[model samples]
Target chain A: MSTTTTAPVDIFTEKIERGENIEPRDPMPEEYRRHLIRQISQHAHSEVIGMQPEGNWITRAPSLRSKMILLAKIQDEGGHGLYLYSAAETLGISREEMIEQLQTGKARYSSVFNYPALTWADIGAIGWLVDGAAIVNQVMLQRTSYGPYARAMVRICKEESFHQRQGYEIMAKMAAGTPEQHEMAQDALNRWWAPALMMFGPSDKDSLHSKQAFLWKIKRESNDALRQKFIDKTVQQAEVIGLKIPDPDLRFNEETGHYDTGPLNWDEFHRVINGDGPCNRQRVEHHVRVHEEGRWVREAAQKVLSFEF
Target chain B: MTKTDALFHYCLRLGDDAVILGHRLAELCSRGPFLEEDLALTNIALDYTGRAELFFQYAAELEGKGHSADDLVYRRPERRYYNHLLCERPNVDFGHTIVRQFLFSVYDRYLLEELGAAKDTRLAEIAVKALKETRYHLSHAADWMVRLGRGTEESHRRVQQALNDLWTYTGELFEMDDVDLLLLEHGIAADLHTLRALWQAEVKQTLDRAGLQRPADGYMQTGSRKGIHSEHLGHLLAEMQYLVRTYPQAAW
Candidate 1:
């Protein structure tokens, strides 16, 4: 343990500067762990609650294949939340506490999830854009400074790619199908496009968490940078799928080599994040209902396990 | 239409297969033996239903049928449906439910992979997407198969008994008649002969892992592929089809 002659802060500073991953056992500032837990837990809650919108379409999916993919994607999201919560557990936070925070509305997930998955195309759009943007964020998080979170991201990124691909394929088929099908695809994209942009979160200038998060290497890049990257990648992908992205002002400027998009509706974003969106109360209420309904099942499992032990 | 139109019918057949199985599983919605398993079952059921919707929608388009997915699912009479009898059978208990899911998921896994190679673009694309989901379902069911099969004497014995009782129904899944023959000619449906061996290998391996003996595979049942069903389908449809039949214009 004493083999190195480096001072504590100096070693910490070097690790942070080099973007080396920090483990639970590693010595780091308490603020770093606390911040990671806060953000990661919020991310976990988002994944968990995110199940609702698409879940509504589970029984109503127009085809067996779509139902299966949607189910897998939702189940995968639950697994993802478990992984993230487990990672946060390593940071010395309790799962119950994080869940409590989520219930109390003290934590925040991605605001995009607050919107409902209203149709089959909404499922496609979510997979193509919402999950697509999430993959972008998660792929970067795979290189994040927390070892467990990074490892979790590695697994999540692999599954999320399939989700994105299936979603894109869905949109491709619809775009090439009859006019009605094309309209459904366009409608889904219109509804989801802006929310997808908001998923990257507030711009760097307005983001209070970005600097400390960036400095600690908890976040790989600034919010604005990630948002821009997502925008650039999505624009071309949308074109290939033959769907109209809702942003009327969205364009590629050859001069700056950047996408020029319309202003983000921060007001709506804030309202949704603050639990004022159309589906916010319904989503949470449903989550609670299901949880309560499953109480007996959890008890039965516990009962069976006890006998085995 | 050439045999290729059979591909369209074949897609509907696959869709109907999943939808029926999903509906059967959904019957266990609040009755799961345990919570996690309950959620898992419903999740799997939802997956099947979603897959059915995709196949049905595509099939409707291919057939030039004016029917929407809802219309195909709710408006069809029982005799017009094409699902195997095994999927429509009621879940007797946890043992029976798990056994059904375990066997069917293995079959689906193999079948979907073969369908992934279909010459028809829509079928191929649908299978490619569905194959991934089926793989997960197979793995999940396999895990439970091993757990329940090896966990306790009661679990082991009950699951084995369930397997034996349910064995006959499996034969219907491979029964290829006019629709199957037609789809095969068009490269829409997978070659069932090839899929059978893979399904056998997967189920056998999982049974072996769980320390469960293979129930004798003799005395397999048939006729369900030809629109024949067990007594359960009528009861199932009575409940499931009731809402839409009664409401007619209900939306949520």
Candidate 2:
């Protein structure tokens, strides 16, 4: 019965509109709290799911330096996932509950992860396009209206910038290498480019959620706006590496000063978001299988944890 | 074998043990039970791989042929790899992997400590460089074994099963051959036979605290020194040597 109270909601809304950081103990609106939990947990889930595709290549990485780099990068993703899960816990949801949602397929991770990384160059493409897009979103997220989530993003964004650069460096080297290596770089860019753009989510017009989040300052920018920023910044990077963007419509309009043109395959994006992507089932199934298998291990850890020090 | 030949073979045993175990652990990179554990396991794998590279480099120099580190790692035949049989065992499950890691880390730390004090400055330097990482790995794996062993009925059963399954391979860690004897005579290697008593005592204490049982009087499996391995090593080498085998001297 007490959960139905809404008088304090107005004050919380006012604080958000004024751009004040929302702390965990603040008497926030029920919707606000739910929204924060959902968004934060989904984000946390994304970091965890994101590790798989890149992690698959660690043993096969062509060089010692590459193996170490990929391992460290993937490790950073795990650390980021842990940090985000901790932030989500501040909203009164347990990590187990959040993990359950992800396992049960009720929660959503980024659809970009639903694609497979087929080659070494794909790792580079992921770091450049995928992580590059993530940084843009996370940089905005760092400025958003939640104390703990914002703090988490600050730490994540710092690491993410390095990830973007590492990928680009790989691409730069590959594109300059032999013909086969250059082709591999180009192939990865072509395959991953559209998926990277769709990572920003649907456009502002068709978007079903997050507008109210914007008014509350939980979302600092529109999906389409962020997507545009990703495209504008990434095109030049592709050009520098001698890899062509797959879009024929990609051109700079001097008037709008934005990279414009190209129909994003929103149908494919929707399909992937709805669990129809190439790796959607495998990704979710693997996560579920591992989680299930880990029950005994977790149980053991819990038992030890309960013993008196 | 000449003294140099023995040193070369001795270094290969060290290098191969690290490389093979590191390869097994690397197979678990993205597949950990959880994010933190994934990070933890991979971090350990990285350390082992780094140490393997150093050991292989030293071995290549000791052999003093045209061989380089990668030549030792990628070009060597299956029979030429001299890793302990304990290291090449598959990571069947988390309990199995951690238990195997725990058992080996204890031996590894002890061996590294003795090697670090060797008369050969090169062996001593490499041992000192590697001992820090071995100690860290031992702490991590030992902690996990205790947790799983004392965790729950199911956890205890699975971990106890792993301990029993892996216990036989523990004997090979103390096995010595001509290479070991030669290196020991020159004060360039540890007395592994002596370290075994220390290792077994520590293991007994650890298992006692974790509420796990250790098998007694099992037929000990040995062959790493003889270059005989289970079916797992062949598969590991096939994948590990694929690119190298395909493109000979391919530079990434």
Candidate 3:
């Protein structure tokens, strides 16, 4: 609000509006710094937390090829987490601090991960749908105003395209497979459909952070816009694979040339995000346990790095 | 004494070792101490599974009973799995896992080298393809062994303890039975015991480089070659086969 600071703030905002990036060393508003750090770290946490559900299927993957695909996919999520965490670090927060925030439940990852992957078909559903939504959201964020986050988003979007396709391929096979397989695929789609939608976050009116984030060019699309895009593309794909999407109200809108769907359970979404989802506690607890148990190994590795070995 | 019989069994053993170890590593997928290491371990596991599939497919072909690879991996009882006991050992900790991988990779490297030169073109071709992966696995696992051993007091102690505990199972990696002997006579299989000295030397050298001592080798454990394994194999198989067994009609 100070006269002197207003000029620099205007310049920063103007650069973002002009479609240019703000480097880490550039003078940024404290609010902008905090927002970037929070969003980027949460993004990183989602990737890290995302590994658990898919990893559950790695050992039990029915085929050699599927097993590899699942393993590679989970590994990619781990890699994404590293990239995003490193990206967040450019905003001046340490990786340990962000991880601590996650561990203490002081911060949140994607609430979608709070749902358990109960069956192998869920993997297919996730790769196809969850990743599908992420791709839409990420494609937009690739133009984010922050340089490192934008660059990281570019790399992630590249890898994520394959993830969604691989997932769809699994769904395609199951849908064409035996009756039991078709049923499993349908069940997976049923369970995952709403969740994948929720990954775009709440609607515009309900998303408290969206206005500021959008103003800062951190998110190039509203949650609703990205969700609409994902829903439009995904509904047809489900039909092609002979799987019924869970949304009973889902239909293509001829007038708008977009898919119209049922209302989301914002209460359930809030509950899950507020630590009430089925796997929310389990996921956080697992992360905490690993961090605690891994302290010695990390310390040992660090010691070697410090040449104290 | 039939070549097909010995070759079929030899290939099954190789496939079994790969899949079993691959299963163990796969279990460590999300539980890795760190992200990069998690990816590294799973990448190696992917190689193991890939190698397993190749060997299993070849074995199924040699068996000539229309048995698919799934039957070999999922339908078999624990006692029918001929993986080296070291692989069947649980990944008790990072140190133990590293030591186990180091020992197995050393044996596997030399084994692949000899097999790469087999007179049987198909087996030789498979070996030549697999040796590349095995060499990489050995170097990665060996480097970890050195780091963990030389890293700190805790890592050093844990890794040395792993070496002592796993030393017995190490002998089984080089155990050759009549099936192997029969294949060796016709150059369809390499004599596993021939690689024992090289394995020992490499292991010793790696441990020494890590500033750790190799445990004295005595009372070597054997029986995996005879389809006998530790209790751990059954637990692994239970989880791995659950989907296939519970839903015989299921297709992944």
Candidate 4:
């Protein structure tokens, strides 16, 4: 309470140790701001890039109901990206800078989106598994130390739950339908399962930023722990829907009360992160292309704004 | 046509217009000029999709044939679709998309305003609900029309090009035949011919504000009344109807 005697860095560390939130104007280490900017912007980029695959199927959504739902869901993802970009902006990075970093391959998004949403079932699988995985990590982030990011996470988590359910609903319907539909669902699950797992990032020991992140309370859970939690919950949901988890190595351990999975292909994960995945170039290219194409529109809007002012 | 038959066809035409235009907007989901614009486009697409569902459901009810809304949306072949040609035009760019949306939304706003007072309560109710959304859509599109028209030289040029290309299709929106005449007599549909003047004035005002010229009207496209469409509708349907057509018995 004696702020006159305390250093700002000590107060920052003390606040972190005492599990207090960090506001935008609060005195904090430069490293912490950098960490949140990188993480949050990457998360924002993921949301924007994530739209492409799901957007792929909006026109082909089988039912009018499904089309509306899918369109709304993609809109939600776009909205989430906006919120996140604003959140990151609080830390001093411009939206333009973050987007430039992404386009230039200096920043990274979740590698899972690099995969194509190949079938209608892929739409379901993405909603169910991909969003499901994202929710587990994001739910933990709701308690993270950063006030703005945590608040954004809280709102995002709410919509993400709906997204996950809609996805699973698609998977469930397909799993229970005709053989072709069932095959589509299963195939989608098989392809998406590992990539979804990769969404949690590397294992605790191997994760580059886990140590500092945990010490700062920016991250509330280890990547492995969060991934495990997602796996345990999702496996049963898949079982009830009569679809199998593609992981042959998956098993529930009564002792730990956790479902264990096969070793993730870290090489593939790294490869995708390094821009070798099937859709990596396509995603970034599309983003750059869209941004370039919209230059005139953005310029026009900017000119109009100036004129009005 | 009987009153009920006229009502069913009326519903289909309305539903088809919504679905096709919604489909075109949906194609721009992640491809908008920017993130905010992207979300706005999809939101409009969603509104149209929802309206299409309501219209299709009503059509299904009137037909008394147990066809679900999905069936009406997915099972119909391209030639069977009665949407105006404008609805199925490709979204060539942001300029084109905005121009197309502006043109349709102006017409839609006037049509919905009249339909909201229809003697047929169901159609009126649907129109009333839809009018709320259309007003927002029209304003959003109109704002962009002005901005793009007056914004920068490049934007003005691009949008003007889009306007000229899209002008012909606007004629088909007012191409009323038996369905409109019959439904008009029954108080189930708005008078398209009358709606056209209001639509034209509103459009001209926006164009004037945006500093753009209305294309000289020429050879207006037709045939949506007979389920005929541009080459675009067939391709749009093939992509849209693929899943349902591939698995006819499968429920989504």
Highest-scoring model, TM-score: 4
Runs with alpha carbons beyond 4 Å of true place in candidate 1: A1-11, B1-19, B23-76, B79-252
| Clash pairs, model 3 backbone | none
DockQ score, prediction 4: 0.81
Report per-candidate DockQ.
0.10, 0.56, 0.59, 0.81
What is the alpha-carbon lDDT of model 4 when measured against the actual structure? Answer: 0.92
lDDT of each: 0.77, 0.87, 0.87, 0.92
Candidate 3 vs candidate 4: the lDDT winner is 4
Question: What is the interface root-mean-square deviation of candidate 4?
Answer: 1.3
Lowest-lDDT window of 10 residues in candidate 1 chain A?
A300-309
Lowest lDDT 10-residue stretch of candidate 4 chain A: A300-309
What does candidate 3's lDDT look like per residue over A75-179, in tens digits?
A: 899999999999999989998899889988988899999999988889999999999988898899899999999999999998887899989998998899888
- Global CA lDDT of candidate 2, please? 0.87
Off by over 4 Å in 4: A1-5, A206-208
lDDT of 3: 0.87
lDDT tens digits, residues B1-252, model 3? Answer: 688988999899989989999989988887888778888898889899988999999999999999888778887888888888898899988889889898988888898899988988888888898889889988888877777877879889999999999998877777677898887788777776668888878888888888998788789998888877777788889888887888888666
Structural similarity to truth (TM-score) of each candidate: 0.66, 0.93, 0.95, 0.97
Q: Which candidate is the best by lDDT?
A: 4
Candidate 1 lDDT, B62-151, residue by residue in tens: 778588876787777777777877787778767788788888888888888888888778878888898888888888877767766766
